[model samples]
Target: MRPKIYLFGDSITEESFGDGGWGSSLAHHFARTVDVVLRGYSGYNTRWAVKVAERVFGAAEGGGGGVNNEEPLVVTVFFGANDACLPNRCSAFQHVPLDEYKRNLRSIVSFLKKRWPTTRILLITPPPIDEDGRLRHPYIENPSNEPERTNEAAGAYAKACVKLAGECGIPVIDLWTKMQQFPDWKNACLRDGLHLTRSGNEIVFEEVVKKLAEEGFSPETLPVDLPLITEIDPRDPLKSFQQ
Candidate 1:
């Protein structure tokens, strides 16, 4: 079977298979070499994610609680957009306290490591927020109409994520800091305020590919599951299977 890569996070990851999305880009880039699995929960926070992780990661093949025998090549922990929402705002229902958010991330990393010690795990921080853009595209009705999420708040979460990765000795994609480095990033990277645009997805795809390469999962490094059509001889197609 081909190796797998699991994506775990919220709405941004849930929509990552849409046109020009990073997940799709990675699937295309890897082709026959690996499988990219999406396990996204729209509007989910780290607090909620930890509760359902085992069920999500456990394999359904042998039985309800059976574990997938083959370890995934990598698993991405991408979250915090919703967790960073202001506690007193319209989206307050989704807000997770900062300290708790950090603990949840640590718990998640611990779970993945205990379950699959050899698997490479990476963390992706929440992206920068565009306050005015969020106001323009409000997700829910608000009595005060204030933007529920701010870039400053997201940055705090992002920094925590980065620090966690450093402590764990794992790779991390600091989307919050990286996106801002680009000029007009608010317009270029985000669609509404938190969700990603095509360009934003590109940054993710490129960064992930770099991480995968560093961990020895690139196209040239990983073995393709099947031989190319050209590799099969018309007269003796069976020869391809022998290899």
Candidate 2:
């Protein structure tokens, strides 16, 4: 069976397989070596993710949980954008208390580790939001004309994610911090002050690849899923085919 890489999280992840998305870039990179499985639920926070974690990663009665009785090669936990929603400013439906957010993230990592001990987990902090961009888009209702989420609030969650990953001994991509390093990040990386633009996706894809390489999941190290053309014998094609 082919190896698998799982991407799990909220809308950012949900849209990760779309055109010019990070997930798609990874899929292309790992072609013939593994499959990239996307389990993104739009608007979901860690709280919601924990509820469905088992269904997605748990072992089946007669079958192995992940690919080929081995845990998925990698599982990315990306969230916090929605959870960082300013409670008083945004709808309560999406706002998760900071403490609760941390708890939920820990629970998610622990649960996955318990079920798939060999799987590598990478946590991704939410990217920064542009208040001006948000105001222009107005995706959320705000009578006070305030953005539902702010860079400052999301930065807190990002810090929490980094801390959690350190405690758990896992890798983390602190997008919130990294994205802003670029000039004009608001327009360069984000589309609507929330979702990622092509540049944002590029950064995410690069970071993920770097982490995978560090963890020995690089295509150079992994066995290709199919036989190479060079492996087939030119003099005895039938025998090579059978072999």
Candidate 3:
């Protein structure tokens, strides 16, 4: 069976399959070598993610459709944008206390470790927000057009995420910090303050590939799904196929 790479998180993740998305880039990079499974739940925070962790990743028993027989080679956890929403903001429903957020993140990592014991886990910090851009979003409901999230708030969660990754002995992609270093990052990296743009996704994909190389999963080490065409017999095509 083909190995798998699992991506778990919230809206940022759910949209990772979109045009010029990071998930799509990874899928293309590993095409035929591994299956990329996206388990993104838009608008979900770590608190909600923890509740359904087992259901999504638990090992199967008795031939159920669960992944009992196969474990993902890599799993990435990316969340926190919604959780960083200000308690009194328009997006209060998604607010999660800093302490609770840390606990939930730990729980998520623990669950993945238990279910896929040999899988390498990567934790990604939520990207920084652009308050002015967010306020300009047509869908925002605040009368004062106040942004629901702030880069400072998201940075705090990002810090917590990095700390948790260290405690768990996993690698983390500090997107919040790294993206801001780019020139004109506010407009180049994020589209609506919270979600990533094409350039941002490219950065994410690049970082992920770098991490995979560091973890020894470089393309040179992975197996291709099919044999080379040169290996097929020209004299007997049917026989070569059967072989």
Taking the tens digit of each residue's C-alpha lDDT, what string does model 1 give over 68-143?
Answer: 7578889999999999999999999999999999999999999989888999999999999999999999979978
Candidate 2 residue-wise lDDT, 121-200, digit = tens: 99999999898888888766678887888999999999999999999999999999999999999999999988999999
For model 2 the TM-score comes to 0.93
The positional error of residue 154 in candidate 1, measured at the CA in angstroms, is 0.2
Clash counts per candidate, in order, are 0, 0, 0
Model 2's C-alpha root-mean-square deviation from the true structure amounts to: 2.1
**Ten-residue segment with the worst summed lDDT in candidate 3?**
59-68
Off by over 4 Å in 1: 59-67
The models' CA-based lDDT, in order, is: 0.91, 0.89, 0.89
- Name the lDDT value of residue 149 in candidate 2: 84
Error of 2 at 30 (Å): 0.5
